[model samples]
Target: MAGVIVDTRGLARSEQNGRGSAEPEAALPDSDRPELGGALEALSGEILKKRSLEISSTSFVTIISIILGVALALLAEKTFPFPRPLVAAQSACMLLLFVCTFYYFLSISIILRWAPSFADCAQPFIITSLEIPPTYFLGRVTGWDACLAILFVFVAAGVGSTVMWSPVSHFGGDRKAQRMLHRIFREVAVIFGTGALSLASIGLAAHFAQAGKMWWGFGSCAVVLATLGALVARMEIQLSRIHAYYGVNRPPFN
Candidate 1:
């Protein structure tokens, strides 16, 4: 039964248009909105640097995952007809994914601790366009619990994806790179964390009851891992686009 109305910057632009200003917000210079973190061009430069450092940290997880996978394959070959080694390899992979997911969850929690809640605040989800009445009384409208469970699962998957490819460690922990990468990760973490919070408050899917909840629980776990693999692929594409924007050059882009 947790929810909020969304009626801030998400709709502020539309309000300006209705007044026949021809979207002046877009035309206004970056200096006009100091609250928006200033100039887009400068922001892009910083974004590039931060994302590069993130990519390097992300690379560590990628390299380690690949090496582990290859080693398992070779071990399986050596074991040949032995089922135990194959089973062990599978278990290890699962353990690695789970550990990474758990770490990602921890990182998110750290951000949430400092980030303000979007629920029951001035920044609620506006629903005037949907005719649902932003001020409608929506207390415990049944099935809310199930919706929350599903949302937690999805958020888990989303955050897990962020870290499945990027493990945080000291491999590239030079003084400046470390500080910059941490800052970049912090920003990404906050955005992702806020999103997760908003979704969790609103909830997802349908209601599950009795023994069915157990089945849904297992399914959610599988979804988290699968989502991580899929997101990693998408992350590569995103990194390529960012690199192209910043001018693709040598690795360790400073």
Candidate 2:
């Protein structure tokens, strides 16, 4: 999506060469009102807050997915291993699900790493801003954090691929080749992630069969899937509103 990145650098250059020194807001031409700077800064802050919430919500969903997913896998493995075909299917789905979650967090984290730059981009616009150091990472930078994060993403993808074998084989190539696939991670996660839930639901039903209560475990999974569906719907609505607000027309590839 083409967002309205307030080119503060360009705007500052224009303000400097075109209009000589700082003066009262009222003194500037209507086209170059100082108040607009503050307004844009405020909007940027609001957008960042919204993005942070999106990150948190997605993280929470992934956590719940992993926990319930693990439980479902264990239940199925103990009760319905070997000859059952679902053992193979559940294992594959879980692997892909992990891959999607890894990429999802990595995408958000990389975007957040640029937040300090974004804060600097907001600086001059604020009338009474604090002198912030240019090195903010939302909090602090722990030693080995970057290394651990990179390792985490790759490890998840590696294990997931090992399980699924030919899963996502279409997107295997250099970075440039995978650009189109990268853009649609959210869509993939929602669609295939739903598929993952279905596998888990079936596995749950199979597990409860050993106890002669085949449908009991499915009830819990159904609730979990419903909650996840609601979360995805909310995220889609948020994206649609953001695109509408920014007049951003994302091409199919992007």
Candidate 3:
């Protein structure tokens, strides 16, 4: 009887071992599974490559701007035959350009990091500021020629606004359009206010110049102020758009 029981127990142990071996055979080795790990690694590498490319492109643009700015300053110094006092004015304008460019690059870096979507919104303001110093300096040194340049700039601004408006409206949806339209009205009011202020500054500068005020020299100072006001108005509009894009509806007055 003891032999029979022992044989029975041995039979049960053999069956359990056989089942365990069969279960392992049914399950494939982890190495032989789908290449999920390799695919994910490839995807990660692609994303890194794309990010690197974008960074490179942005750096290239900034470098090009810096080079162009230097060339512009050199050409202005060599070509324009102004009086010594006017040279100071020219140098001031160039300095402003350099400052504006540096600020722009800084702003780009900040916006890219903090608010990339708002970067486009801020671009026009930078461009408008860049145009100002040259316009003001040229107007002071060359009189009516500067006004012609300013007029051309205004026309360009109008054209650019028109070109950008439709696309932005379409992309932003109805709610965004409504917000933008409201902001546009506000911007128009700001523009008018800036224009009025500019006209006043022009009159004041003309008065001072005619009075033989050596300190006032020409209308350059007034032009700079007007240009700054114009840029500020443009920036306000851009910031408003950014706010609207982000679904921010804080009070405009705030």
TM-score of each: 0.25, 0.26, 0.40
lDDT by residue (tens digit), candidate 3, 183-241: 54345445534543554555466554555433343454445545444644564556556
Best by TM-score: 3
- Measured with C-alpha atoms, the lDDT of residue 55 in candidate 1 is 58
> How much is the lDDT of residue 154 in candidate 3?
53
lDDT of prediction 1? 0.39
Error of 3 at 66 (Å): 3.2
- Output the better candidate (1/3) by TM-score: 3
Model 2 whole-model lDDT (C-alpha atoms)? 0.39
Off by over 4 Å in 2: 1-111, 114-213, 250-254
Q: How many Å off is the CA of 199 in candidate 2?
A: 16
lDDT of 2 at 195: 40
Q: What are the per-model numbers of colliding residue pairs?
A: 6, 0, 0
Q: Who wins the lDDT comparison?
A: 3
